[model samples]
Target: MSQRKVTMQVIADTVGVSKYVVSKTLNNKLGVSEATRQKILFTAKQLGYSKDGPSEGPSLPLETEIENGYILVVLPNYEYQSISYTYWGAVFQGISLHIQSKKAGMIVITSEMDLSKKVDVPNLIGIITVGTVDEQTLLALSTYNLPIVTLDHEARIIRADSIFMDNLGGIERMTDHLIGLGHKQLLFVGNIHYSQSFYERWIGFRNSLEKADIPLTQGNQKILTIPYDDNMEANLQQHFEELRIHSTDFPTAFVCANDHIARRMIVLLEQNGLACPTDISVTGFDSLEEDKHLSPALTTVQVLKQVMGRRAVDRLVWRAKNRDYPSEKILIVGDITFNESIDAPKKR
Candidate 1:
């Protein structure tokens, strides 16, 4: 007679551990200690254990018997008090929609919302982080060893998948749009070194100019040293200072990294008696509707925050099912929104 199949249960029986622990260890999921995982793996190898499941991937534990299905969602450090109904809010809505469909629970927290605060996460099957997070947070999460996915974050490790907007492509499209409007002497605002996304956007800006045979002068790239890590007012002051420093020789238009910065530049320019698209044209990325300060609508890239969130959740779900696959970096594209913020440069 043929030998009996080597199941996870047989390995568990040999290791004096639960079948669930062996399954978790094999799938690289949570709820298994490192030592136990190693022991189970060693024993399974020794026993020549071959999975009875389909070749596509390992089958998940029966849903009826295992009730532990919870996904932890981490957002960048930002207040959700007023932001709950805006861009981030839409993203959360998308995430919740997916989790609800999957019959799973979720625990949402921000970096600033729970720094050094330990909360109970009993059944964490996966983690999804939105936006760029600090290195400390990334280091802390790397220990979980569970499937993690990110949206709009460029700082992700080997275990995490990143789903973000095509910052470089969107920026290039916006820049070309400005050039089509007959504007030159363009300035790319915001500190490019702050984040990987920003650096890519700056590159797009430079590339667009080169493609159009336009010179990107040294003074055109304004590197504003802002305190974006924590303080808002300080960051605003610094951005204004960088713009003010070149007030005498202001470019015809400015392409900001994001909408928030672009809105602030418009306000500061107006305060100094320069009107947007009249004296200076300004374009931005991530067209959020919550900023009521933008009277003259920003000609920017419209990134679908909710779509990005949904895609990230989908990737996380895929990762949860397939443990052996390499991490993926999916780029979501944005559309250019034509608005009153940019126009042809006025006659000299």
Candidate 2:
């Protein structure tokens, strides 16, 4: 049986654009926008269009090609945000190991680097971004029109598949755990505006409080909305000092946004002559490596960091096969690890 031939007209019709636009896009001409060009190319690939005729095989960006070609991993260019950090390091390891297992090449570049100037476009099959990437950087990556999958982040200006942990659920669970310990007065500690994940964690905290019939007071809101900056540490200390002066208003426990913040809070509490799980209980998210060796382990949510990176690779491969499909946001669920940090509130 003979199959119908795929043509530029077919792709143009699928993409709702003029045949002239499709022609220009396929030839890599200058008229069309990067987004439009990518759409046209994806549509053409989906329809099996080629210079020779409708191809029996998938397009250039396919599983086979992805295995043979290199995948580029983009990370934020911050001193503390690199792969050396506990969370990001695990994620990068997952990505590196998965790529190695697939016999595929992988190149990592920081967002600080100019994509067009640094990247060898022809040899690359796809891109996987680890953390927050600015719109300008995203736009630069878009010029290549490759399939992009982001881990623990999303792009505001471009279309890409996103993979994130169950931020809301994890925190909500942790908060519920704290509430179960009879800690009625709980304070959330984190700059809610720090990142999307952090903001969601704050929401989760509020959700749990609401569920427990706890009022969302202005005092609680103030702690969650701390300004993120160099002075934040000082501000946090000042808040602690005030809490000490007004012991009646102090929370029974501190629910921090992440492990680092939780650890910092514990230190500050000790400095203020308060003891963790005695005077005040504490909880943290992101069950990091350091939690194992600490005198009193941190109670935190176990984010599947490596799984995020590995699944990102899996998603890129999926994208390669289904370029014409709608973008997807993938969420991986994580479990909470109860440790020495959380306890019943001491009677005043």
Query: How well does each candidate superpose onto the true structure, as a TM-score?
Result: 0.71, 0.79
lDDT of 1 by residue, 1-348 (tens): 656677889889999999888889999899887878878887776676766632232334333211347888887754431346576778777887777777788788777664455446776787888777887887677667778887777554446888878999999988888889897768787777777778889989888999998865564553344434446445665655655634555578889888877888788778767788888898888888776355898888998977877787778777877665557789988999888889898765
The CA lDDT of each predicted structure is: 0.75, 0.83
Residue 256, model 2: lDDT of 91
User: Which residue runs does candidate 2 get wrong by more than 4 Å?
Assistant: 1-63, 78-83, 116-118, 219-222, 226-233
* Residue-wise C-alpha lDDT for candidate 2, range 230-275, written one tens digit per residue: 6766778888776663386688889999988888788877878888
CA shift of 90, model 1, Å: 3.0
True-vs-predicted CA distance for residue 145, candidate 2, Å: 0.8
lDDT of 1 at 206: 82
Q: Which 10 residues in a row give candidate 2 its minimum summed lDDT? A: 57-66
